[model samples]
Target: MSKLIIPLAIGAALLGAPAIPLPSGAGGGALQARELPAYLQCVPYAREVSGVRIFGDAHTWWSQASSRYERGNRPRVGAVMAFRPHRKMKLGHVAAVSKVIDSRTVLLDHANWSPINGRRGQIERDVKAIDVSPGNDWSEVRVWYAPLQALGKTRWPVHGFIYGDGAPAARPRVVSPPTHVAVTRAPSRQFASAFDAIRGGASPAGYRQAKPLPPQRGYRQAKPLVPQQQESQRKSQGQRTGAQARDPIAQVLARYD
Candidate 1:
């Protein structure tokens, strides 16, 4: 068999032993490739053992069209693929199935993978692949087996593969709320209130009121004389002068008048 399949055979043998429970957070929704056990609470351990850079959460692994896992989705050869988020764990998780040694065993590559409080980056650990049922239900599954040397320097209870507890029927898909839409509505109200405050001190349209001009200087009124009245005054003055001319003394008196 291929080198990849050998580890799987070893993992299958351990399946008969007592099962080890996965960390509480795994198993809720569809798994994605990048979302393997790394990048979550398990990241610190995965980096130490795998000697690879792991960043971002599992959501990065999703390919919108195909529900099935693909290498194009993750790019890395041995990278684990995670499923979509679920109600139980907001982030979904999965592992990269590296090698299939036999019907009962497969080589699993996963980071930050271990029992509760276990070390990370346990590379290419041997896991048993039991075909308990033909369908894709999570419950009809077998446990994975990890060797002591593969676990690096860290030592804990040496247990065999632990079968996963089957998930509930009718698994629910997790949907994140639309945050961008909510923010758009809030800015409209806040803008209107700001405009109203600015208008209060000036015009309702938010323009400064022009100051009233200083009171006009007092107006001087002159007597109004008709054109005919002005002409009559000139004739009367000429007649008086003519009568004064007839009498020398009267003329002098009239001139004085």
Candidate 2:
């Protein structure tokens, strides 16, 4: 009766558990996991092509470049155009400027932007991007969509352009040496005694110059502590002792002794 109750509880728990959707090609129980196709994201692709080293989400690149890279609203070749997060684009997007057509239009090279052949993460090069802002400040833009074969209707907001030209290299961190290192009690006592001797105009006769340490070298065969003759004699004595212990006649003699 108790065993039946345990089985029933397990069955109820499993039935209530939610079903999780696995990615395509991730086969059933016994099959080994397969590698998914490479998906190139905008951030890494822009950094690789434009030479911008800024990290984190695409939207954050504008603020992060304030100290490291130069930024402006006007687009130029090799500059990354940062987009502000709008309705569906919660993380925003970035693209490298491939060519500057004029003040209002430019060519872009980016990835994972538009769905091509019904698949996302497709790379698009030299696609059109136009400044549609009322003041022509490049604050809003319309980018090319592969499916539509024209500029997308949505006016994606722009944070501006992050220029990689002459971007300052990250300064190496400078860790200042510790000002107050603790002195052990034994060393302090020794120093105090030496100071007292010097103050009293008395020479410290007990003090001697420390010997220099041995020079460091790569591994070498170590010299035996005892002389060769002594080591050989010790080995001979050990062998005789081991032989006697193993002999039954010697064992009986040893017990009597």
Candidate 3:
């Protein structure tokens, strides 16, 4: 009977028949493999943990938060650290700040950064990330690697941080009032001198010259000579000069006359 049963079981296994019950441990590995957690990406994990609500690729998070969320270079807890595409990381990376150890060090919770069990898209919790930028502005960083069990040697570029709050409102611009000046026009006066008037241009029709100032105290007023009086005085002076030339006694004779 035992020999008959053994032959029957062998025939069942060869023909691919399931007539016999298998052990409880049989195919356990395949079942566990099928039940493994699905691979996760950095973007969704960052959004979920940080509550930044950003979408699309990791590099675009900084720009997308410009108007919607507050962003800066300083790292804060619950903020998403946006990584710029560098080296072989073509699509870039994003991670949530679990803790800020100091000015230059931080702990990050992200996915797909380091592979586990010979597969990618694994989640890493509270991994160390150090700021390597010269200015200490968090512009560059080096993240912990699972394979090396240490911080990676590569200096990855970063795009700053995106906070979980809405952006502040813009301030209104102030304008100054226009200035006013007081201009006084000088009173119009007649030309002070004829030469000045001529240089300025020919006087307009009906233009009159300025009046002279009245004589002041202690000043003598002289009478102007007429044209005829001036000619008579010149003739008399010339006759006296001719008489002197004709006679040597003309000086005495002029005094007697």
Candidate 4:
């Protein structure tokens, strides 16, 4: 739910050849996306480690970087993929390319798409994203989910990849976008108790962590009762005894039947 406000650094955008090269034999691996190690979140990680200067909704990245940075329709390692708006993704999404798994699949690092510890804003590194588009132009794609440990069903839009190595130009031409769009990973609680219910055999955390019961009265460790509680118990017992004394038939039934 954050907006991307990027600085148009003139001399840093990727123009022609990329500065960071792709790994050898990258595209030959499995087609599915994978999850990265644990971390704080995407926004800071993208800005701190990946060196993405832009700040806004992930979808607005293309427009914000269009002026000072270069944009493209391909996927490359260290390049940021700026996604266009789509269903529920009104603002869009951005991810750093970690590896190229053939022309149809690529591994990435991003945040907030996967729920971690009842949180939505945590970071997910080295996750897989597949280009679902049949045109092979890198238009439509499906990203990996962290909590579910699988590829999500949502087909996201792509503006293109924005490499950090591009040379900076003049001041960026600011293209203001609409309101921020929120992205949801799975459903509320990921469709289970804590989203952990379905993932962990449906044993709810609440049930598993329930408080222990009090000891019985005959037990040595039975909790001591307060004066008020003792008084109430005595009054109830006294009433029962008085009723029994008043009825000989009740006493006979108790002694025999």
How much is the lDDT of residue 205 in candidate 3? 45
- How much is the lDDT of residue 190 in candidate 4? 36
1-257: candidate 1 lDDT, tens digit per residue: 34544454455444322223445544532211111232234333333333334444544433321233222321122434344454443544345445444332335555434543364444444443332223322222333434432312211121112111111112223356777754545557657776776667534445466897765669555477799989999899989888766554333223222
Instruction: Please say which candidate is ahead in TM-score: 1 or 3.
Output: 3
Write the candidate numbers in order of decreasing TM-score.
2, 3, 4, 1
| Candidate 4 ranges beyond 4 A from true positions | 1-41, 167-257
Against the hidden reference, what TM-scores do the models get? 0.26, 0.51, 0.50, 0.47
Residue 216 in model 4: shift from native, Å? 74
Best candidate (score: TM-score): 2
Which residue runs of candidate 3 sit more than 4 Å off their true CA positions? 1-38, 167-257
Error in Å for residue 215 of model 1: 99
Which candidate ranks first by lDDT, i.e. highest?
Answer: 2
Q: Give the per-residue lDDT digits (tens) of candidate 3, residues 1-257.
A: 33445655665555433353445555642221112234677888888888888898887888888888887888878888899999788888999999886666789999999998888888999998887776778898878899988878788999988889654322223255668856586435553454466788866446776789999999989888899999999999999888677552333223322
Over the stretch 19-135, how does candidate 4's per-residue lDDT look in tens digits? 232355444532222233333434545655558798765766677887767667777777888778787767666778887755556788887668778866677778877766756
Instruction: Evaluate all candidate structures by whole-model CA lDDT and list the values in order.
Output: 0.39, 0.77, 0.75, 0.65
Q: 58-113 in candidate 2: lDDT tens per residue?
A: 98999999988888877888889999999999999999999886666789999989
* Candidate 2 wrong stretches, greater than 4 Å: 1-38, 167-257
